[model samples]
Target chain A: MARKRGLFETFQERIGAVLPSALQEAQTRVDDRLAKIPTRLNEYGYDAFGLHPESSRRSLATSTLFYRHYFRTETFGIEKVPSGRVLLIANHAGQLPFDGMMLGVSMLLEAEPPRLVRGMGEYFIPQLPFLSWAAERGGNLVGTPENCVALLEADECVMVFPEGARGMNKTWDHRYELQRFGLGFMRLALQTETPIVPIGIVGSEEQQPGLMNLEGLAKRLGLPSLPVTATFPLLGPLGLLPLPVRYRIHFGEPLHFEGSGSEEDDVVQRKVNEVRAAIDGLLQEGREQRAGVFR
Target chain B: MEKVLITGIGSGPGRLLTERLRTRFEVLGVDRTPWEDHPAEVAVHVLDLRKKGFEDLLRTERPSHVVHMGFIRHFKGDPNRRHEINVRGTKQLLDHCHRYEVTNLVVMSSSYVYGAFPENPFYLDEDQPLSASRSYPEIRDLVEVDTMATGFLWRHPEIRTTVLRPVSVLGPNSRSMMAEYLRQERAPTVLGFDPMMQFLHEQDLTDAIAMTLEQDLAGVYNVVGAGQVPLHTAIEETGGVAWPIPEPLFRPGVRMLFGAGMAPWPPGAIDYLKYPVTLAGDALAQAIGFKALFGLEETFRSLRGRG
Candidate 1:
C-alpha cells in the first residue's frame, strides 16, 4: 500500500518534481499542520466521515497553490477563533466555493493552534460525481443540522454558510451585501452550546462578475443559478475559472448565546440577525483594509 | 436451566445463536424450513410461525424466553407471500408468546429499516421512523415486523421485549444482502455517491443477542459494529471491485438485471448504495454493556475468501 500512489498524489508528485523547492515546502507545511490535528481514525486510517490524512494531504497541497500564489490570501484575527467546538459563520460568495477554501486554509495555516474546519456543503453536492467523494475525503460533509450537531458534540470546528445559495448566486452589484441568514445555525449553536465565530471574506465576491442571473435556465438545468457573467456562456467551462483576486479573510471574536435551542422562531431569527450583522461589520472592515482587489 | 425458543433456526445466525445460547439455556429451534443436521441435545420443530402447529409447540414446550428471527429477508418470491409470512407471521408469533406466557421476547430487527437517505443523521437513534418502505418498498414486510415488535413492547409490558436492529451483518456464516454484495468480485455501486457503511460480524451479532438474553432490559435498540467506512473503501477492504454506474443508468439497469435474475438486489436497494443508514449503538452499549469485538478490518476480512 505504501508503494502505491493515488491518481491525485501522482499528479501532485509530478507537479512537485517541476516546482521542487516551493511545492516541497508547501507539502511539508501541510503535513506538519495535519499531524498536530487530532482525529479519531479507524484501523484503516479513515475518520468516521471518510477523511483520510493521505487524501487530505493531496487536497491541501492543491488548495495551497491557490491559497499561497494564485490568491495570495491574507488572513486577520485568525487567533480570535477559540479552541474546542466552534461554529465559523461566514458570508459566502464566489460562484464556486473559493471563499470556503480560503477560510478553511486560513484556519489550517494561519491559526495559532491549527484546526481542521469541517465544511457543510449544499445538498446537491452529494449528487455531483467525484466531487462528493472528494469533498468527504477533504472533511467537508453535506450541511445537515444533524451533521453539524454531531461534529460540535465531538468538540470539532464546523463551518456553516447561513447565507447558503442566496449569497453565492448574488450578482456583482450585490457583492458584500449579506443575504437573509438561516436561523438553523443559531438554533444549533444553542443546542450544542457551541460559540459562533463570525468570518468576513473580501475579494471572493469579485471573482466572477455576474451581470444577470438566468433563473429559468438554472431551474430547467437543475442548478442553483445560471449567472451571465462577462466571460461565462461566452468562454464556457474555462470562463468558470475565477480571475486572480487577492483574498482577505477576517475572523472575529467568538459570540456566545444561551438558549435551549427550542426557543421561538422570532428569537432564533433575532440571534441569527446578530450573527449576520457581525459578519457584515467584518466584511466592511476587510473591504476598508484591503488596498485593492488585486493588491 | 431456563428454556429459550429461537425462531428462524435454519438461517445463518440462527444456528450460531443456538450454539451460543445452548450452554446457558435449554435451546429449542423452530423454523418453516428443516434443520437437516443432527443435534442430539437440541430439538428442532419445522412449522410455519403463522400456523396452529407452532402455537401447539409453544404451549406444550412452554419456553420462558423467545428469540424471533424468522422473517423472509430476500426480495425473491411473491411479494404478498413474503408480507404475509413476515408481518402476519410476527403477529401470530407475538400472540403465541403472549398466550404461552413467555417471560422474554427478543425480536432481531435491522438498521436498514430506518432507510438510507442523504438527509439521514450520521447515527440514527431508535426513535427515527421506519421509512425504508418508502424507498425500498420490497422491505416493507421487515419494516412492518419491526414496527409491530415495537408496538408489542409497550402493549405487552409483562413480556420483556427487546428489538435488536443490528447493522448489516457479514461473515463466513452470514447470508445478509451486504454480505452478498461484497461476495461479488465486481460489485455494482451508484456512481458519484459513496455513502458511509457499517458492518457487523455474524459472531458479534450472536454475541449481542446472547448479551440481550442475559440482561433484563426491554426496549428498541440499535446494535452497531465497531465503526463505519466508506462504501468503496469497504468494497476494497473486502477484496471486491466497485463498478460505479451513473445514477441515471444505474437504477434502470439494476431493475432490468434483477428482472433477468442477473442482479443481487432490486432497484430499490440502490438508494441504500447511494445514501448512508448508519446507527448509534449507545443505547444497547449503556443498557447491557454491548460492544462488537470485531473491528471494521476484521469484519471485512471475514468476507474475503468466502466470496
Candidate 2:
C-alpha cells in the first residue's frame, strides 16, 4: 500500500499552488461573505432548505469566476436593499438563470454588509438532476408561497422573478419588455408585511438571443420552453453556453403596499402592475445608460 | 391505575411504547402476531383485530384508553389482506372505542399520508389535505385509516381522538423503511434529487405518544423532529454511501427489487427520495410543549449498528 505519489496525485497536490492569485483572493472573499451572513443552521450545519456554507462556498467560488470575468456584473443602488425581510423583485432572462446568479452575487459581494439573498426558484427545479440539490445548496428554494412566507418571517432576504418562465423564455424581439407579472409575490409581501425592491437587468436578454419558442417541443420534453436561440440549434449543446455579455443590474427603491393579502384579483394586479412599471422604467434607464451589450 | 389498550404491540415501536407507558398506566397489548418476550405487567394478546375475540377482549378489559397502531406498515404482505386488517380492523376498533367509551384514542398516523410531492411546502400543517394516495396507491389504506379516525374525532366529541402524523421514526431496533434503507452499505438514491427529510428518534415518538395521552389533545397534528436534513447527508451520517441512480432506472429498479422482496420499500416510496414531506411541529409543541431531546445526528446514528 506504500506506493509513491503518481503524476495525478502530484498535480492534485499542487491545486492550491497552481491556482491564480485572483482565484485565491476570490475564494477568501466568498468564504468571508458567507461567514458574515446569519443562517439558522441545524447542529449538522445545514439550513432547512439544505443551504450549507461548504456547499455555498464551492458554488459561489465557481460563480465568482463568471461574475467577475465572464459577466463583469455592475450594480447600482444595492444599498437600497433593506436589511430585514425584503423581496428583490427582478426581470429574469437568459435562457438559463445567470441573471439570478448575478443578482445573488451582487447581493453577496456588492451590497453593504453583504446579505444572503434566497431566490425562489420554479417548482420544476427540484425535478432536474444535479441542478436540484445544487440550487438548494446555493440557497434557491422552490417558489412555494409557504416557503417564501417562512423565509420572510425568519427575516431573510428573498429574490423573486414574477415573470417566471415567460420572462426567461422570451424571444430577442420581446427583449427588455416585461411580461405579465404574477400577483403571488405581491400577495405574499402584503401578507408578510415585507418591502419589495424592484430590480432591472440589462444584458441577460442578449446572452442567448432567443429567436422563437417551440412550445409543443418543450411540452413533449417536459421543459418550460424550447427556445430556438441563434447559437443553440446551430452549435448544438455548445451553443447553450451564454455569451459573455456585460451585466448592468440596478436595484430600485423599496416599494411597500398596504392591506391584508386577501385583496381582489384586480387590486393585487394593480399593485403588481405598479411594481412591473417600476421595473420597466429601470430596464429602460439601464438600456439607455449602457453603450453596448459587450461594454 | 388507568388502563390503556395498545394495538400492534408486537412491533418494535409498540413494545417500546408499552415499556414507556406501563409505569404510569395499566398497559394491555393486542396484535395478530405474537410478541415472544413481553413484561408480565403488560398482557399481550395475539389475535386479529377484526376477529370477534379482539372486541371481546376490549369489552371485557374495558380499557378507558386505546392506542391503535396495529396496521401493517410494510408492502411485503398481500394487499387485500393488509387492507382488510388496516381499514376494516381500524373501523372495528373505532366502533369498539365509541361503544366501550374509551375516553382517549390516539391513532398513530404518519406524515407520509401527506404524500411527497414537489408541490409540498416546507412545513405542511395539519389542515393540509391527505393526498398521499394520489401518487402512492399502496399507502391508500393508511390514508383511509387517518380519514376514518379524523371523522370519528368529530362524530364522537366525548372521546378525545388525537391523530398524530409523525415524521419517519428511527432507532436501533426500528423496522422503519428509512432505518432499513440507512442500514444498506450502498443506499440507492434518485439522481439530482435530495429532498430534506425529518426524523423522530424512536424514544421521542414514544414520549410524544405518552404525552398525547396525558394531555388528551383532540385533533390532527403533525409531530416533527428537532430539525430536518438532506437525504444525502442523512445517508452519510448513517455511514452509507448514496448510490444515485437516474429516475428512469431507479423507479422501476426499486419496483422490481421490491416485487422480488429484495428492497425494503415499495417503488412508490421513490417520490420521498425526490421531494420533501416536511411537517410543522409547532402545533404539537404549542399544545403539549413537545421538544425532541435527540438531535438529527444522534437520530441518524441510532440507525447504525447497536454496537
Candidate 3:
C-alpha cells in the first residue's frame, strides 16, 4: 500500500505544510509590534511630507530583506537619536544609496521607538521615473532648505548627507575619505534648534566601487554624476546590483550649538568642521573594528 | 440693510454665495447668462461685465458691497474673448466699483496665479508673485485680474477690497478645471510627476466669501481646504483611473486631444500636473476666522457618483 511520491510532489507537499505557518508567524509578529506602537505614531501612517504609509510599508518590507539578511547591518548607538526633531548628519558613499536605506531601516527597526527618518535626496534623483515617487513615499524629500525647515518644524527626524553628491560619486581611490560638508545642515540645526546626530556608515564604499565618472554625459542627461562602476555599463542593470557588504552604522552623541540659524560663514564652517571630524573619527573606528568587508 | 452686488452668479460659488448672502444682505446677482432658478428674494440681472449694462446695473443697484466673481476662465472661451471678459471686463468693473463708491469689494481669484514651478515653496503666502503668465500665456488674464485687484486694494484703501485666491474649488456643483479633470473617466497625469494639490470645496469657498463680506477683511488672502493630496492619489480617491503619460509626450498628447475636441484641458496646463501650486490658508484661518469644513477625503468623497 506504499505509493512512492515524485520528488516535485514531495517538495510541494513540504512547502504547503511550512509556508502558511511561516507567513502566519511573520504576520502575527508584525501585528503584535504594530499594536504596541501608540496611535499617535500611526498618525503619520498615511502621508507626511510625501511619505505614503502603504508604499513605505511595502518598500520597507522588501528593503528589510536586504538590510537584515543581505547586508547583515549591525547598528550601534541608535539610542543616541533624540525623541523629537533631529538632523542626522551621515557620511554618504556607495555610488548608489544603500547606506542611506540601511540607516533608515536601523532607525525604524532597531531604535526603541521606531522612527521614520526622512532622507534628503539629491536634486536629480526625484526626476527619475518610479524612483522619485517611491523615494517620496519612502520619506525622501528633495533637499531644499524650505523642505528641511518644514520637516524640522513638524518634529521629524531628517537625514542629510552634508557632503552632497560629491561623496556619492567619489572614485574608489577616495573611498572612506570625507568630502567637504555643506553648511546647510548646521544652519538648519541652528535655525530649528534641533540636535545633530553624526552617523558614520562603514562598508558602503565597497558596495559599488566607482572607477570613473562620466561627468559630461551626466550633465547632458540632466544627471548629477554618472559613475562608471566596476560592474555597471558592462553588466547592464544586473551590474547595478550592489555587492552584499556587511554594514556597521555608528551613531555619535548629539551635537548642539548655540546661535541663530544665520551664523557667520566662519562660525558655520567651524561647526561644520566639528561635525565632519566627529564623523571622520567614527568612520575610522568603524573601519578598524571591522574584521572583513563581508563580516 | 447693505445691498450686495455679486457678479458671475451663473457659476457654482457665485450661486452658493448669492444664496447665503441673500439672508444677510439684499443680494443683486449679475451674470452674462440668466440663472435657471434663483431665490425669489434675490434680484438677478443678465448683463456682461464688459458691457455698459454692468455699470448701469452697478449704478442702479447702488449696492454697498460688490463681489466680482465674473472672471471668465480660459477653458470656457477663446483666448481673446476670455481676455475681453476677464481682464478688460475686470478693469471696467473695478472702475465702476471705484466710481460708485462701493464700501467693500471681494474679487474671486484663483491660486493658479501663483504658477506651478518646480522651485515653488510648499505653502505660498499671499505675497508671492503672480508668475503663472511666465510660462503659460492662456492664464495671463487671471494674473492680470489679480494684479489689477491688488493695485486697487492699496489705491482705494477706503473700499476695503479683498482679493480671495482660493485653490481648486471642487464639489458636486463645481465646473472648475480641477473638478472637470477629476470627473473624467481617465484623468491624464504626467508620468513620474505627481504634484501635491489642494482643493477648496464649493461650500467652504462660499463660506470664506461670506466671512470676507461679513468681516470686511481687506487683503489678498489664500483660501485653501484643510489638507493636500498628490494628483495621482486624488484621482484614485475620486474613483477615476489615471492615464499616466511621459512628460515629453504629455503636451503633444494634450494638444492632439484638444485638437480632436476630446480633451478638457489645453496643452498649457501640463506644467500644473508637473509641479505644485499649493496655497496656505493661514490668512483665511487666522484673519478671516474661517476654516475649511471639508477635509481632503471629504472633498474627494463629494466627487463620488458625479461626472
How high is the CA lDDT of each candidate model? 0.88, 0.88, 0.82
Q: How well is each residue in A1-295 modelled by candidate 3, as lDDT tens digits?
A: 0011143246434654665554344344434443443323222244536666554554565466668768999998999999989999999999888888889878777887878788887766655656766777677887888889988998888999988779988999999999999999889899889999999999898999899999999999877899999999889999999999999999999999888979789999999999999999999999999999998
Tens-digit lDDT track for model 2 on B152-217? Answer: 999999999999989988898687778877888988888777788999999999999999999988
Which pairs clash in the backbone of model 2? Answer: A129-B192
Error of 1 at A156 (Å): 0.7
- How would you encode candidate 1's per-residue C-alpha lDDT over A50-129 as one tens digit per residue? 77787678778778888998899998888889999999999988788899998888888888788899999888777776
In candidate 3, position A203 carries an lDDT of 87
Q: Write the per-residue lDDT of candidate 2 for residues A1-295, one digit (tens) a residue.
A: 0011133235433654666675677788999988888888888788977787776685686677789988999998888988899999999898988999988888999877888889998888887776777788788888999999999998999999999989999999998889889999999999999999999999998898999999999999998889899998899999999999999999899999998999999999999999999999999999999899999
Roughly what TM-score does model 1 have, to 2 decimal places? Answer: 0.96
Give each prediction's DockQ, rounded to 2 decimals. Answer: 0.52, 0.50, 0.21
Question: Which is superior by DockQ, 1 or 2?
Answer: 1
Please give fnat for model 2: 0.73
List runs of model 2 lying over 4 Å from the truth.
A1-19
Residue A18's C-alpha lDDT in candidate 2? 60
